[model samples]
Target: MERSLAALLVCVFGVTTGEFVLAGILPAVAGDLEVSIPAAGLLVTAYALGMIVGGPLLTAITAGRPRKPLVVGLLAVAVAGNLLSAVAPGYGVLFAARVVTALVTSTFFANAIVIATSAAPAGKQASTVAKLVFGMNLAMILGAPLGTWIGEAFGWRATFGAITACCAVGLLLVARLVPGDQPVTRSRAFGEFTVFRNQDLVLAIAITAVANIGLLMVFTYLAPLLTGPGAFAAAAVAPMLLVYGVGATIGNLIGGRLADRALLPSQLGALAVLVVLLVALWASPHPVVTGLLVFAAGAVGFSVIPGMQTRVLTTAAAAPTLAIAVNASAYQVAAAFAGWLGGRVIAGPGMTSIYLAAALATVLGIGLSAVALRRDRVRVKQSVLR
Candidate 1:
């Protein structure tokens, strides 16, 4: 149990660091590559797009195979991608490297969730999944800030180098801890799509996507938001991010417990909190207040992720791995859309508009969650009657 948990943490830390380190180094990348900041921002978007595409595709292709080799292979690819970026001659090559790494990272992330949940003792599945996800939030707290500091002090390429080292470490851990034999209890990859046909699962994914859209809309522009007028200085951005990470870590732990106790209520409460917090952010721009709200937003938004995953996994019990993988893909796709939306809103109105849009999306997500809960209750009653 300890080894499996450690392995999951290592994989998640590596992948999350690789995925989010870009956000902290965007400015440096822009200057180094001689591209406009917005243009350089495409690196983040490209990576997200890769995840959106890679999650389901890679999972389906590797269905029923031993997960260890696939995870190690993906980590190797991530390391290579970061290395390529570290040495790439120009923006184009760096962008390509990010895309490749993103695809590999997505596979690793989805598989990590599957492995974590499957390895957990039956009743403790949510908690196990939460521990794995905690690594992701931990990356935001520790990895992103450290990457930002390194990129600022040394250079953006140094951030990639750091991620490469982390990936190497992750590969070693995975080899040692992950089971050598493939678990072949289920070979129903195609049937996993049946999860989509289930209204509850469909609504769950839809709300998950909507919630992420709002979350990422603000997240993609968080550095800018913090560094803007009346906000924190550029140097303070990392610390603020650390606070957000704290919130996310708390959320991950609390969310798992909440889901284990009462899944739907936890989901609804998290979404509602997110909506309120985002609206508050839109209304207030004070650095101290905004920072707290940002932390709250991270805490509330992330709290739903584990619960959502649990819901989908339960709904598609026969093919939990595929269901979880597809849900992971939905998250990235929503992130891509949210980033684009933030860019659009930033272009039109300004940074403040990003939060406003996010707040609106959060409200929509809350409504979706409410409907899902109602539907679930009705289904439960029907099952009891039958």
Candidate 2:
């Protein structure tokens, strides 16, 4: 079981790297593709759009397949997609490759989460999920900075090529280490929607979306934001991102433990921290202050992931795989919307607009959580009465 989890974590690291690696190298991509920086930023939107469409669809199509092979197959596809990206001749080709890559990436998350939670010891679902998600934080820590440096030193294409190699290594490790051959029970495509009947599930998803909107709005354009006002030199972006990555790792670990003890409180506390961090991030302009705020933003921003995912999974226990897939899709939808919204703000009201807008979005998320908590209490009281 430990080996399986380790393999899944490595696999997740590769996919997560693919997702956020673009952020650090956005400017390099824009220059290479002869497009505007915002245009390059839209690559994040494109990938998110693909995940939005593919998460449920691919999960439905591949339902009941043998689990281990399914993961390996998806990783192979990711390898191909990244390879295409590495050799893309223009913006259009790279855009197509990103969409294709995201389809596999979203499906991989659904499968891997189901596998991890199932293999986990009793009462450790959130912790196990956090462990898998640690790969994402790790990617942010290592992959994003390394990819950024590679893009600067070599070229953006070289960054993709390096990711391609990582995906291949992940593919091999999964096929060898993840021990599973059990086939899922055949499931109808439409059955995935049954989880939505529960209002708690719906509310949990909404919270996820709203929270992400706040994080990604500022995060998607962080490279430029750091460089814009001489807040950091061109060479300093990677180190700043590395700092954020470290904070993210710490937050994810603490969030998992807190959620295992009390889901609602963990989420609320994280959001509260985020509100403060976003304000500081916007108001502070000094290099030291901005760097510290960036690290805090990363820490506070990601601390709710385990709680949020655990809430959705428990609420939709009847359709765990599909529900997990839907939550993954929700994240992508949030990313796509936030990335596009950030681009629009960057174009019009200027870069500073993103932090303020993100802070307001987080306040809305807090309101949604209050409503959800109230509803949960009412439901519990009714159950006791019955």
lDDT of candidate 2 over 65-139, digit per residue (tens):
777888889999999999999999999999999999998887798788888888777778888888988998888
* lDDT digits (tens) for residues 1-386 of candidate 1: 67977976986887788788887789889988899999998888888788878777776666666787878888888889989998989999999998888876656776777777776777777777788888888888888888889999999898889888888887898888878764543564554555567777778778778877898888778888778743678888767777888998999898998888888888888888787888888887577888889889988888888888887777766556666777887888787788779988989998888887998888888788888889878988999999
Write down the lDDT that model 1 would get. 0.81
Which window of ten consecutive residues has the lowest lDDT sum in model 1?
Answer: 182-191
Q: What are the C-alpha RMSDs, in order, of all predicted structures?
A: 2.6, 2.8
Q: Which candidate has the top score in TM-score?
A: 1
Misplaced by over 4 Å in model 1 are 31-36, 185-195, 223-235, 285-287, 343-353
Angstrom error at residue 77, model 2:
1.1
On the 0 to 100 scale, the lDDT of residue 84 in model 1 is: 96
Clashes of each: 0, 0
Q: Best lDDT goes to which candidate? A: 2
In model 2, pairs of residues that clash are none
Tell me the deviation in Å of residue 66 in model 2.
Answer: 2.8
